[model samples]
Structure formats: C-alpha cells, structure tokens
Target chain A: MQDPLGRLAAQIGSGMKLAVPVDYGGVPMALTRAIIAAGIDDLHLVCVPTGGMQVDMMIGAGLVKTIETSAVSLGEAGGAPQFNAAVRAGRVAMMDATCPAIHAGLLAAQKGVPFVPIRGLIETDVLANRLDWCVINNPMADDTGDDPIVLIPAIHPDAAIFHAPMADRFGNVWIGRRRELAAMAYSTKTTLVTVERMFDGDLMADEMTAAGTLPALYVTDVAVAARGAWPLGLWGEYDGDVAEQHRYAQAARTPEGFAAYMASDVRAGAA
Target chain B: MSTPTTAHEILIVSIARLLRGTRHVAVGAASPIPAAGAMLARALAETQDEPKLRLSILGSVAHNFFTNGSAELFDCAAQGRIDAFFLGGGQIDGSGNVNLVGVGDYPEGTVRWPGSFGSAFLYFQIPRVILFREEHTPRVMVEKVDFISAPGVSSEGIWRKGGPHALLTGKGLFGFDATRPGFHLQTLHPGHTLEDVTAATGFRFSHAHATPETPPPDAATLALIRGRIRDELHESYPDFAATLRTAPLPSPLKEPSS
Candidate 1:
C-alpha cells in the first residue's frame, strides 16, 4: 500500500485501545495528524511511557476519551499544556502508570502471561488507587521469605502505532537501538507504522541491522510518510523542530489557541 | 579555592557529594540540577579514579545507554543495580511521602499536577532516593501530601529496599531518619539561617546544637561543573545547560507551583 495513511486511519476504530510511542522521537506524528484529520473519537490512547505533541493534540481535538500512561509533558519545550488542561478539567480518564509498569504490562502480554511482578508502587497512592493491580509474595523467595511484589496485569492494546527512521517494502522496520518498539509491536494485535524513508534492500539481510529490525510479519500495515514524526526527532535521521514545538507549546496554552492550532486538521477531516 | 557564586551550584555539589560511592546514578526528566549532579559525580569520578559511575539522565539520547527505553532503568533498579536516583514532588510530607499526582484528592483532583511517572516505582527500588526540589517552602514540604505518589517509608511487611535518603532543597539539605521517621536539619545553605529553615519548613525536626553551614563548591569542583558537566548536559538538558553559562541568580525561593 503506497498510500497507506488512509488505511492506517481506517484501522483505528472508535473506542479501541491504541498504543503510541513515548516522548519526543519515535512518535508517528503524521499518522497522528491523519488520525486527527479522520476525526476518530473515543480513543483509548496508551502513550508508551509519556507523549508530548501527539497525545496533547489528540486530547485537544477531543479525539481521546482515556489515556493510560505516566507523565504527559512536552519535556523541555514548556510542558504539556493541553494534557494538563484536560486533566484539570476532567475531560479524560487517566491511568497514571510509571514507565516500567507500562513496559512490564506490555511485556507480559507479549509473553502471553497473565501478569508481571515489578519492584515498585508499594507505599504510593498509585498502588493504593490501582485496585486492579495486586501485591503478591515473591514466588522465588530468598532467606527473607515471602517478599511482597506488585504485579501489574497484562496490557494488550488493539493496535500499536509509531514512526521509525527506516522501513523496507517487506514490512521490516529498522528501529535501531529502540528495542522497546519491538516489544510494543509484539504485544499488540495490530501494528501500524509510518517511516521517514524506505530501504531498497531487505532490512534483515545484514546481521547488524537485523537485531534492531522489527520483521514485517508483526507489522499489519506500513505507510511511507516522510518526516512523519515531525516536531519530534527520528533518532539519527533528523532532529525535532524545536521552534515549532515551542510555538505549539505557546499556541496550545489556552483552549481557544489550541482549537485554532488544530483547525487545519478539522478542515482536513471535513474536506 | 574560590567559593562558588550561586546557591544552585552549591546544591549541585552537595548532591554530587551524596553520590560519591554510587555505581549508577539516574536522574529523571525535568530535573536540571540533579542531572548536573549526576554528570558532575561521573566527571569527578573520572578525575579521582573512583569506582566507575554510570550516569543515566532520562530523555537524553547521548547520556543514557538504554536501548529499550527507561524500562531498562527500572529492570536495573529491580535487580539492585541502580545505586542512586532523584525524585521531586508537588508536595513532600514529614514522613517522606512525596505527592506528585496533584494537590487535592485522588480520582477527583481539584488541582492536577503531572501524574506520578516513576517516583512511586523508583522510590521503592533505588536504595538512595534523594528528594530534590528548588522550592523549600511549607507549601511543598507539607504537613501531609494530599496524594502520596511515593511513600518514604512503608509498612514492615512490604518488601521495600529503597526509600527517601535525604531531602535537598534550595534553602537547606535535610537528612531523613527512618528511625526518627522525619527529616532533621543537617546543614543550612549559605545566606540562609536556622531561622529561615524553621520559618519555611512545614515539618518538625530536631537539629544538633552546633549545626554547621553547608559548604560552598570550591573552584576546582565549580570549574568541572561549569566546564565539563555543563557541556555534557547539553544533549539531555539544552535549556538547563544554556542557563549554566552565566552565574545563577540568588533564589528568593518561590513555591514550585505558585
């Protein structure tokens, strides 16, 4: 599919759980923009650990109903204005998870396990509040037996979507050292990707890149959206548009400005 | 040795001192000072031939070695590998409870701050979890946090290997006593007195009769911090690094949110 953006948009049914990449780079901004343009609503958006532009913009556009992840901030570029506003306004349901909790949950799903035990969330309100999560005795106990560990339930999203530096026609995408992308792809039912560029030769042909390559077998769809993760970096390929991010941060400060900033997407959807 | 100019530098060096013997020191996102401290510790270790310090600054492509994202950091901590970590909060209580969730109640927050990221997790896993906040007022160091993002101390039954080690702020450095179950004024920072600490701090604590002043960073240490550490911080914290070029302004120490 040469123009797979439309197909990718179609895959995201309303009320479905959609997993995206973490902060800054690796976010599929073009597809995110396309998804926004498509005006899909009631999305259960799962930011990998946290999300910046994509999550904020989506929430601002009233496309998402729930967000499951940790901190949602713009990192150094002023903080997530839109996300903070929505949370304070109680617009979306948020599952405040840590980076590991999200990863461990995804890993458990990938491994087909019911749950995974992690060494955290004992005394915090995060633990107290998460009635769904359980604290169990460490099965493999040392001399100090019955060590309590927090076990997070598996998180299998309906779809995994991200932007990578390169991908081949065969569906293999080179994620470089960002191996978490592989885990995300494996755990989810559908994996949709957009890439900056496509490699002519097979990505798995070389043993060096093979390890980092998420074989197309796992990837359900591919779209060649060059500079797809805009205002966010593509790892080694390109840097984030810092000025644009700063402008976005300023523009997204208020509800009116946020609406104005996202007017183009709304227009695109209507068109 | 020439005395360091700013209180921020003093706090950075003080934090680095706390990380002297640590093998791996990790600083989370939005923490410019702690990031500098970790980098400074690594740089200092290089000069002194100390045990190799693996400094990991979250969100930095150049500084961090994690190919699998911060999950690897958590994995390392779970295995008892990470020696030190830094955490801050919107509200930190007397018992070492940190509240990063928000100001008010849970499930229905009146004032929502950033949701707890890894504070709850790391505070329980990493042995040395230093609570750092530029603001040291009663508003931040509260009588009780509305929401506990990470509890400083847990019940006896819970398998906890880590909790609050110390509380570092703009005004002073307070050491946490698990036995005391509270923070004791260790040393007041330069330009601040015991009265200032007492007036500002919401939590009650004891101090020794002769509590000395917190030492300022010496010229060599300041030079390393300003020169090497400053350069190293650019990749992860460009905004913070840019601020380090000039001597930091003396803090009137405004409340974090207010």
Candidate 2:
C-alpha cells in the first residue's frame, strides 16, 4: 500500500476516478496512464499550473473526471493565439481548481510547524479558513500581540506516483532534482516510482543523486517503466509532440465534449 | 533560389547552450521559439553525432511544444520535471512587472488582453526564466505594465517560487539584478545602438554607458544552423520546409568545409 505508484493507482477505488497534474512529460504522464489503467475515470484529472507531466490520452480512456487548475487555462486552447475549437466546445470537464499547489499555502501545511511564515495570505478568507493557523510571539513583545507565525499540517496524498531516471530493483527510487519535490515526496503517504532503466545497486552511489534516493525509500513500489514520462516534458534534453497537444486540447475542454472525443479512439475509449 | 540563414535557428542554438545539457527544460504555451528550440536540442543530442548528449523530450498534450508535428521523444515526458523555462510578455514595465494575461475589465477588455498565461509562477519558481522577444518595441517594454502579471519581490510571508534570470532579444540582452529585481543591460547586439533601443521601449531605463555589442553569429555556426534548418528540420516537417522556398549562395562557412 505504501508503494507510491501502486497505491496511487489503487487509492481512487478504480472505476475510473483520478486527479493529477497537467504537465508535458515525466511523472505526470505516468500518473495519467496508470490512473486510467487502474480504472479511474480519465476525465477526473488535475492540471498542474506549471509545466509538468500530463497525459491527454487518459481522457480518451474515459479515466479523467475533472480538471482543477487556474481560471486562466480554461480557454487556453480554445481562443486565439492558437485555437482548438473542439476543446472550447467542452469535451472534458474543466474546473477553476485555483492552483492546488499554492506554494505558500501548501508549504504551510507540509511542515507541521505552526504558523509557517508566508506572504500573500493577507486580508483574505483563504488565510482565515485554516483553523490551525496560529501566531508566534515576536521578540519585541509588541501589543500588536497577535502572533506572526502559522501552522501548516502535513498534506499526505493518498499516494505519490513518479517516474525517475533510475531506481534499484528493490524499489529504491532516484530523482535528479530536489527543488520542491521533497515537499511532495514527504507529504504523501504512499509513493509509486518508475525508472528509466533498472539497476542493482543504490543510485545513491553518485554524490549528486545520492540524496535523491532517500525520498525513494519513503516510496512504496518501484517499477521499471522505461520512458514512463511521456506527453509531459523533460527540462534539459527532450522535446514533446506539438500536434498531439493540439489534438488533446481540442478534445479536453468539457465532459460531454471529451466523451465524444474518447469515443473516437478504441483503446483509449474503453478503460 | 537558395536558403539564407535564419534568426530562428540561431535563437534555438543559443537556447540549447543555455540549458547546459539538461534533458528537459520547462516551457509554457504559445512560445514557439523556445518550444522549437527545446525539441531540436533533444533531436540533435539523441543522434549518434552527439551520443554523449543522450537526451529526448515530451511536451504537454495541451500544445506546449509548438513543433510542426508529432514528436519522437514521448517517453521522456513521463518523468515530468520542467524546472526551467522561457516566457513572453506583451507588457513588461520598468519594475520588471509582466502582463500577458489580459487587461482592463472582466471578460470584455477595456484595454489589453489577458496578461500572462503563466509568467507569474514561471518568473518565481521555475529557477530559470529567460524572457525573450524579437520585436523590441515600447509597447512590449513599458515604464510599468497596466497589470503586474507576476510579483518580482514576493512578500516575505510567501515563498516566491520563480523569478526570471535573463531578458533576450535581437537588440540586446538583459539580466536581473537580485538587488534591484529589474533588468541591468548586459550586451547590445550587432548593428544596434542606444538610440534604436530606447526608441523601441515605452518605459524608463537605466542604460549603461559602456554597454558592449553582442558579436554576430559566426560563419561556421551559421552554416551548421543553415544545414539543420534546410536539410534536417525540412525533412522532418515538410510544411515548414516548404516555407524555405529558396536558399542563398554559399560563402565562407566552415572554412569551405575542409
């Protein structure tokens, strides 16, 4: 159950229900396909605000449920600049998810530290809703005495699925970059990893990727899914398919719209 | 007729070097230059000629990589890490404020279009944000944008994700000053001057007195770029290839190819 990828596939209770980022390649792609194969509705997808691993084929598989993203992306493909009329017509369900990964908000929750100092939460209900937010006494002991700090409870996903460059057969994973990935890695209760190629020893032998393996140990299952990060983009070396993206955008703007689009494909149409 | 050199190819090469051999670099929607460059870099690196640089890519299905057609590197996308990226701005104010989304009222615009699609987060969290443009105009570079698409100096309470590093254009290059958070002119390009630059911008600038000019793309590099666009890229995308209706006569490229 702790194997991130495996648990992720199982968490949504099969029957086609899933939510994941909208990315170009890598982990996001793995999540989409795995979700579909696991029997989650492909239409229930969460779109990452930034560039990340995402798959449109899942929608064609009737595996997506809803898109939780920014209000800006709602019409990204349908309007001018570059228009995909079919997507605008509502083939998939799009939701103004309001960027689930608000760095400050999410970071606050992940640390379990009360009142994690964060900006941009001023004067809004968003800051008020978190009952756990508590303030810290300042050194000055000023009468403005309401504390300044806040508490961010850890946000462990039902599971975290990822595609890594390398992983040991035992399921020890290796991620090349450790930006905010640690936040997502530790925050999740379960993790699934797919490596580019299998290896026997610990990926930690290399100094750079050594620390990368620690988080993998926190994961549940490690699988060898070569080139698992498809559709979503990789940063330095590879590029993605532009035409397929257009086709996806044309298909994934609404529920009914995407359903018809899914019907067009055989394998993708039936989950 | 014959094919001449192209700025697009030159721009793509410049970007590949910036990536420093990373397998994937993040890109946003509607940015054709970086998208194309990112794809081309992966293609060249994967080929036997540059086997040392083993790389490929997978763009988003929602049209992130504006390549001419389907991409060959679909497998790499499963890894999903777009830490660095490039963005565009229709209005970049002196304060380094960007506005690409839309302007004016809700829905119906009294003024500009939706300011930025993703510049806000891209500028802060992506680690590397290389803002680029070809047409340097006052409209593009303003004193202050009507809207601040992304916050350069995010409030201390908030951990500002990504911020831009460089501003590239045909006229010159600008890098961000961590202290100032705005642009410090780095280098001017060939056949350009302060007058030409200032004339194009709509904002106030602190120009450097000794700004140097960027050297033009060299002959050898140009030839290599030409070959890729004409022969390699053309073969990949016949439609794009057709755009190159003719070629210019050859000159001193690669010292006559030995």
Candidate 3:
C-alpha cells in the first residue's frame, strides 16, 4: 500500500491489533472514520504528545486496546510531564515514540559524544542495552567532541504512520513546522504522508522548499486521503469537525460503540 | 548584562538563563518560549554564575529550523531526560493543574480548548515545568477549573503537598511554598501590582512580604534568544515571526477563523 496511514494500519494489523495516532478533533475523525470503514480489529488510539484528551475516553471505554505515552499532552494538562492516568490506571504500554534514532543518541550516550559519532547504526541499534536505551556519562565537555563509543538498539515498530501537510504520490511528507516527523519517520518501518488535495496549497510544488527529510524510496505508500490531518492543519486548510470527531473518539473506543458511531450519518456514507 | 525589551523577549531570555549549564530541554506545542530560550543560552549568553554553561535543547518546539537534522528531535538528547519544559494553559487553578483539554465537553466540546499536546507526561517527569500566559486573567487563572485533564498541585492545600514546580505569568512569578500549601507569592513584574495579579487569579495567595519586583530580562540574553528565534524558528515558520507582533496591539488576537 502506498498510502501512509493505510500502510501503517495494515502493517501493525499483520500481528498485533492496529494502533493509530489520534487526537481529540481532527486526525481522530479521519482515523476513526477509516478504522470503522476498514472494519479493522479492536481499534486502539495512540495519543501523541500534543494530542487532545478525548482520545483517553476512547481508551477508557475500550475502543482503544491500550495507550502508549509519557507526558506531553497531559503535562500541558496536569502541570509537569506527570503521567496522572498511568498512576491511576494499573498498567499501560509505554514505548518511546522518539526512539527512531535510538542508535545515534545511544551512541552519543555510550561513547560520551554529543551525538552518535557515526551513522553505523542508521537502521539498527548497536547501542541499546535495554536498561534505559543509553546515557552519556562524560556529557561531552566540548559540545562538538566525540567521546566514547557504544550502541543504541533500534526500538521502532513493525510500522509507523504520520500526517503531514503535504506528501508526494510516493509518500514523502513535510510538516512545515519542525516536528519529530523525521525521527518518527526513521523510527517506523513505514512512514506515510497526507498532503493537501487543494491546488492552492501548491503542496506538491512546495515540497521543493521543505527540509527534505525523507526520500521517495523511504516511503512505501501514498494513499490519498482528504482531511488526513485535522486541527493540526485546519489553520492551513481544513477546519476540523469537532462534534463528529468527539463522537467517534468516544464511540470507537468500543468496537460495538464504534460500530454504531460508524453507522452514523457522517461515517455511513464512508462505510 | 542587559535587560530584555519586551515581555516575550524577556521570557525567552530568562529561559536562557535557566537553561545555562543544563544538558537537555523540551519544547512542546506553543513552545517558542523554551525553544528560543535554549538557543539563546546555547549560542549567546553565558550565565555569570557558571563559567561556561552548556545547555542543549531537545524536542519539537526546538524542532524549529535550528535543527539541521530531522533526527535531532529524537533520542535521549532530545526526548529522554529534559531539564526545562515550557507549557501554556487555558485554565489553571491554585494547585497548578492545567486544562488544555476541552471545557464542559470532549471532541464536541461546548467550549473547545486547544488540546493538551504533550503536558500529560511532562507534567510530572520533567524536572522543571514553567506555566506561561501572555495575557494573565481570572478567566485563565481561575479558582477552580471547570475541567482538569492534568493535575498540578490539584487543590490549594495540595500545593503544599508537593505539586507543580513553578507558575510564570505575564504579571509575576510564583513558586511552591514549603510552608504555605497553595500559591506563595514570589515576585511581581515591574509596572504591575498585587491587585493586578490577584484580579487574574481566582484563589487567594500567601506572601511573606510584598513580592519583590521581577528583574527585567537582561539585554545580552534577550539579544541572544531573539537572534536564535529569528533565525532558527523563522526559517521554516516564516509566518511565526511575521505573524507575531512585538506586543499585543489593537489587531485581532488570532487569525480570523479560516
């Protein structure tokens, strides 16, 4: 599959139930709409660092299998990056989403360098010991100095999916705003893109101006989906359908509930 | 040493001072404060306290143009152990809890609040979390939040129980009070009064004495932070710098609902 979200949803479905990055308003609507339409397994919502809270309700109600997070959206919520839900909810699967370049950072930690001295672990982790990825004891006295050498293992996933402002048919994407999009891209086996369908964005042409993080080959799919990324991008184009999104996040948490929600007026046509 | 000329400028400068000698920092959504702060600290100003302080910035807020490699935003250097985390709030109580989640409702929010992007985890794990708001008011600094997606000190009394690291607002600075459970008045910004601060805050505050005056941001720090922001952030986010006004003017606060 060339589509970014599709490839990711499909890849994870190969083994574990499908996991998708979701938020309160925009992407979740598109995502839940897709899940319900695709008729996938127990849909789990992966709340990104900056995601809204309704995604949690989806998890609470069982639409989501489990939540994987540390504390971006919440600290913005609670106070610090404190995992309030984790403290209350017994056990939740927490994985480092930014571990795509675990090898490089780990190399920096192990060798006592600023960053991985070399690109030896580009695709794999030679530096991860498992205790905690890696750490830098020397702390690099000379910000530019290369200290010791160690390996940081690869902790990516079967596949990862993201939504960016623009993407080429091949799947390369650009977020315009600086995001861990690259790290996330590197962290996953598959990185997808959802660009603006509007000709005004001139998104395809604008690609020339972006930082150029991913090459076409790096992306395996390029499925065209409208309003792929929501509130995150409404400023750019599409305004999110908040009410519809809330209903889906709440309903999708439960397969039965999501089924009913998917059967609603908005989702029915898509189904 | 010099002082910052504007509120946003001083904020970034002070952030740089705090970041001096630090190894890592995280800047989440709406994080020009931390991103520009660290860049200023790293590139321009060196704290007088530490001879050669080196603070490295990590995360997406820092994901601004300064990051040469997209890979820089990942890793322990960027994500693992962050020193300072910058945050904002639509609703806050005396306890320090923030409310970025919707008010009165969820996705179909009766009152839509910009979602809590990353604060959920950072609220506890991050060593330092600074709450910020350009416009301080009772609406923002409420007595009790209608909805609390994230808990700070939780309640006024709970503040004494050890929650929320710091509260930095447009009007003044407030920190934890080992003795006083709720908010302990730390200092007031120049050109402001206790009334100005209180009018914005719903809960009562404890103060040992009249709060001291907040020092204006020093010049060297401001210049340094501003330079990075103009260069690092403005590159990809041109509208950021263009869209931003040096001060709140008569113009509309946000882009008219597109």
Q: Best lDDT goes to which candidate?
A: 1
DockQ of each: 0.53, 0.06, 0.08
Which docking category, incorrect, acceptable, medium or high, applies to candidate 2?
A: incorrect
Candidate achieving higher DockQ, 1 or 3: 1
* Fnat: each model in turn: 0.74, 0.02, 0.06
Error of 1 at B74 (Å): 0.5
Winner by TM-score? 1
Tens-digit lDDT string for candidate 2 (B1-258): 134445565566566555555645765444555655555555556552553322222233333333311111111121234445776666766666666534443223344232234343345445566778877888788876655556545545444445676777767777776566578777777667888888987766666888887544455445444455445444234445454333345654534554
Give the deviation of candidate 2 from the true structure as CA RMSD. 10.6
lDDT of 1 by residue, B58-133 (tens): 7777888777655788888888989999989889989999887787656556777767888878888889999999
Q: Between candidates 1 and 2, which one is better according to DockQ? A: 1
lDDT of 2 by residue, A72-114 (tens): 3322233321112212434444432123223333354467542
For residue B86, model 2's alpha carbon misses the true position, in angstroms, by: 6.6
What TM-score number comes out for model 3?
0.50
- What value of lDDT does candidate 1 attain over all alpha carbons? 0.83
Winning model by DockQ: 1
Model 3 docking grade: incorrect
Error of 3 at B36 (Å): 2.3
Give candidate 1's fnat, 2 decimals.
0.74
Residue runs of model 1 more than 4 Å from their true location after superposition? A1-3, A139-146, A265-271, B1-4, B246-258
What is candidate 3's lDDT per residue for B43-162, written digit by digit as tens? 653435444433443333334334433334333323445556666778877767677643553323344443444444345345566677666888888887665544664322111111
